[model samples]
Target: MMYISELMTGAPTNERCPLERRMYETLDKLKIPYERVDNDPAASMEECAEVDKVLGTEIRKNVFLCNQKKTTFFLLVMPANKSFDTAAFSKKLGVSHMSFAPPEKMLKHLGTTPGSASVAGLLVDEDDYVQVIVDKEVAESEWFGCNPGINTSHLKFKTQDLLQKFLPKIHHRARIVDL
Candidate 1:
């Protein structure tokens, strides 16, 4: 795990990643204040839970999914403790055969690795290729947390600001579902 301090010699500033730096720059432009914490590269929901502890806020589970043809992509955000039922999700979304999007697809579309997927990544999605769905339980919370384009750094911000302010700028509409 790499700490935010290690990545920054002083205060944070806008920076570009290998692919696109839109995510970092977007937050700066929006002036959304946040705090970052470093943690291990969490591979599963349980591992992410451990990382959440260090951030002092529960990180929502951001799942990258696709349809059978891999044409349509979706970003489902839910509480870390919530379970994902494919059947229920498929029915809710009115899609046939929804599965996890491949790592290559994630990188190509969102410029993020598997364990580092965050709604913040939407800044780079110029095509609007993915639909953002946030669990109702998560949306109702006061604070939301996620990675800042890196697994080692987690960011905390106001849920209202993320949904009401940041999301609108990215042209993202979050569907609050039961799952």
Candidate 2:
């Protein structure tokens, strides 16, 4: 059985990786209150399910994508349960040929690896090279749940804090899409 502990706000007591540490510092600096849980590495929905129970919110899918050119990169957060139609996403965004980004590029731009990507990665994008996209539905939800720049730790916080405070501080903006 999955081991999901009680929900608690702020960073965990145990030591964390550099990436996760930076994420907590960033959140604290911004004064964006959050609740977090250290679950199994979020590689599968089964693990995500256990996290959802602890967080009291559904964990959204954080997809790392790039255009056909591979020059334009994006991090898209959508409903975890919904299927992502790349074609539909392309059409809605007026972009073309969206495909999953290479893992190396994801690490380079987002400071996160596959299955571990999160909006907090934006803090490391000093170049502001990657665009952030959010599904309208997820953006509208009262609470936002995502990894705090690392897969093992998951966070749930006010959607407003993410949209209004976090994004602006990082000089990143979120383009809300229907898909």
Candidate 3:
């Protein structure tokens, strides 16, 4: 069974990765109160179902994608249950040849590995190179859920805080998409 820790307020007291630490620091600085749970790495949506049940919010499916030329990168946040239609996403963004970005590029751009990609990684995107696209459904949710920067932990906070505070603090904005 996947071990999901009890609900905790704010960030963890134990040591964490720089990216994870920074995520909490940024949230603290912004006064964005959140609830979190530490768990065995839940990399896939299926693995996250338990975490979601514990947190009382569905964790968003975060995907890192890139254009064929590799000049542009995008971090898409959508419902965990929603399937990603590459062709539809490409058409919606008017970008061609969209495909999942490689792990190395994900690290370079989002400061995360393949299964750990989250909007929180935007903190390391100092250059604002990665464009964040959020699904309309996720954008309208009362609470937003995602990992800090790793797959072993998950967080939930007011969606407003994410849109009005967190993204702005990271110097990025989410472009809402129906997909």
Candidate 4:
């Protein structure tokens, strides 16, 4: 069984991976408050349900995608139950083609591997290359939760802090879509 700890406010006192540390650094620098929980990789939605109970909020699914040529990349954050439709997303975003990007790209661009992509990951995107996409429903939510560049750790914060504060500081604006 996965170990889901009770909700703990703020960043962890213990040491963290450089990537995870960098994520917290960014959040702290932005003066954005957050709550976090450490999990066992959180490999499945069922496992995440336990984590969600501790955070008392929905933890969205994050997908890393790329166009047919791999020239354009996207980091999509949407509700966990929302099934991804490549064609539908492309149509709504007015893109020619889109597909799941390889894990290598996730590492190269976001500095994290599979199962961990979030606004926090975008900090390593020095050139601001990847397109950040958030579903309208998710953007409308009051709270946001995702991994801090490490699947083992998940965090909750104000969605407004993500959209209005943290993201803008990184020069990233989410492409808000209904899908």
Candidate 5:
């Protein structure tokens, strides 16, 4: 059985990776209240369902993508259950030939590896290199759930806090796309 800790408010008491710690620090700095849980690394959306139960909200699916030239990078957050259609996403966004960004780029830009990417990663994107694309459904949801830059830990907070406070404070605006 998957091990999931009880729903707890705020950051972990013990040491965490720099990225994860930064996530909590940023949120706390912004006064954006959140709930979190520590669990085994969940590599897939299906596995996140268990964490969702504890969080009381579905975890959003965060994908790091780039254009063909890799010049234009994006961090897209969509409904966890929604399938990602790259072609359709590209069409909707008016970008061409969008593909999953390489792991190195994901690390360099988002500060997280595959299966561990989240909007929290945007806190490290100080240069505003990664364009944040949030699905309409996700943006409208009352609560947002995502990893704190690691799959082993997850966080849930008010969607308003993310859209209105977090992104703006980080100087990254969310481009809400219907997909």
Candidate 6:
């Protein structure tokens, strides 16, 4: 797929999707600079790799998870290639088990679909119910990339800014883990 700029008549700033718009608004409010790249709505990990190439950064896998009772929710960010060890994660979080959160909960809380879960959606999470977890390997990067609350658009920002400024503004905190 071609760059959004080449395929579209106007700039990405004029794109649709309330989630993406809200994320950009927050970035503007904080005076944080970011570069956004739009791609096909990738449906699988391989397709997401194409988006990663276009964005020139690795896209972290954003997983929406919940404990058995569903009282607690988590948004785990890790390297796309990393395998999620439920037992290890449960042990780390002190939970019995962590299963994938349903689509309804994901939409209600993160304002995103299964393939589009991203930290950027935290902009819409007024309750701040979801815990954000980042793999230490992914966190070590100087820059990090994630969806701009839409599957077709990805945003890249300095890792320090993302963890320090962007996440705090959205009332989200990151827990670095080896998983």
Score candidate 6 by TM-score against the native. Answer: 0.91
Runs of candidate 1 exceeding 4 Å displacement: 1-21
- Order candidates by TM-score, high to low: 3, 5, 4, 2, 6, 1
- Give the Å shift of residue 6 in candidate 1: 12
Looking at model 2, the pairs that clash are: none
- Model number with the top lDDT: 3
Candidate 2: deviation at residue 142, Å? 0.4
What C-alpha lDDT, on a 0 to 100 scale, does residue 46 get in candidate 2? 61
lDDT of 3 by residue, 1-179 (tens): 99999999977889999999999999999999999999998967999999999999999999899999988999999999998899999999999999999898999988989889998789889999999999999999999999999999999999999999999878899899887
Off by over 4 Å in 2: none
All-Cα superposition RMSD per candidate: 3.1, 1.1, 0.6, 1.0, 0.7, 2.5
- lDDT on C-alpha atoms for all candidate structures: 0.77, 0.87, 0.93, 0.88, 0.92, 0.81
Taking all chains together, each candidate's TM-score versus the true structure is 0.86, 0.95, 0.98, 0.96, 0.98, 0.91
Task: Show where candidate 4 strays beyond 4 Å.
Answer: none
lDDT of candidate model 6 versus the reference: 0.81
Worst 10 residues of 5 by lDDT: 119-128
* 28: Cα error in model 4, Å: 1.2
Better of 4 and 5 by lDDT: 5
Q: Write the per-residue lDDT of candidate 6 for residues 1-179, one digit (tens) a residue.
A: 53342222212656579888888788778877777776767676677787677667788889899999888999999888988888889899888978999999999999888899999878767898899989999889988888788887777778888899999888888999886
Compose the digit string of candidate 1's lDDT tens values, residues 1-179: 43233222122455435433455566667887766655556666676676666666898889899999999999999898888998799999999999999999998887888888888678768789989998988999988988766665667888988998889988887878877
Candidate order, lDDT descending = 3, 5, 4, 2, 6, 1
- Clash pairs of candidate 1? none
* Model 1: worst 10 consecutive residues (lDDT sum): 2-11
